[model samples]
Target: MGNGAKAQQRRERGGKDAGKGGKSQLKVNEASKSIVCGTCRQSFMTTARAPALTAHAEKHSKALADCFPDFKV
Candidate 1:
């Protein structure tokens, strides 16, 4: 019930090191309105009227599946 115990609980539930020491997993470029994938390092631009981010994520998922056929995402 102390500070150490509370920190330990947070760590167990993936709160303390979830972002690898308070760093973001995604790198966003505000000027270009685009995001670069943290894992594969792929970059893409966004549109005004469509959900381009979702499509880009799907590409990452597909690439992951192709690279690791036996692994479950």
Candidate 2:
């Protein structure tokens, strides 16, 4: 087969399923952690990294405090 034809065959076959690896292929082994905001009573994915969660909390603090003082940080 020509190079073009070989390439077409490879494309048709598709590469190994990238999505079928690691945590994706299997179900989550452990329950996800939870984040409860003291000021807003909002719950977030505790599974997310601490830095990301901190950034998210920082962004929402102003709005949350304004809306619900009971839950504000």
| Winner by TM-score | 2
Residues 1-73 of candidate 2: C-alpha lDDT, one tens digit per residue: 7999999888777766644656562234233435556656655554555555566567776444343334323
State residue 57's C-alpha deviation in candidate 1, in Å.
Answer: 0.9
Report the poorest 10 consecutive residues by lDDT, candidate 1.
64-73
lDDT of 1 by residue, 1-73 (tens): 8999999888889865676665553554445544455556654444322244445557667553343333232
Task: Please report the TM-score between candidate 1 and the true structure.
Answer: 0.27
The global Cα lDDT (0 to 1) of model 2 is 0.54
State every prediction's TM-score relative to the real structure. Answer: 0.27, 0.31
Candidates' C-alpha lDDT: 0.52, 0.54
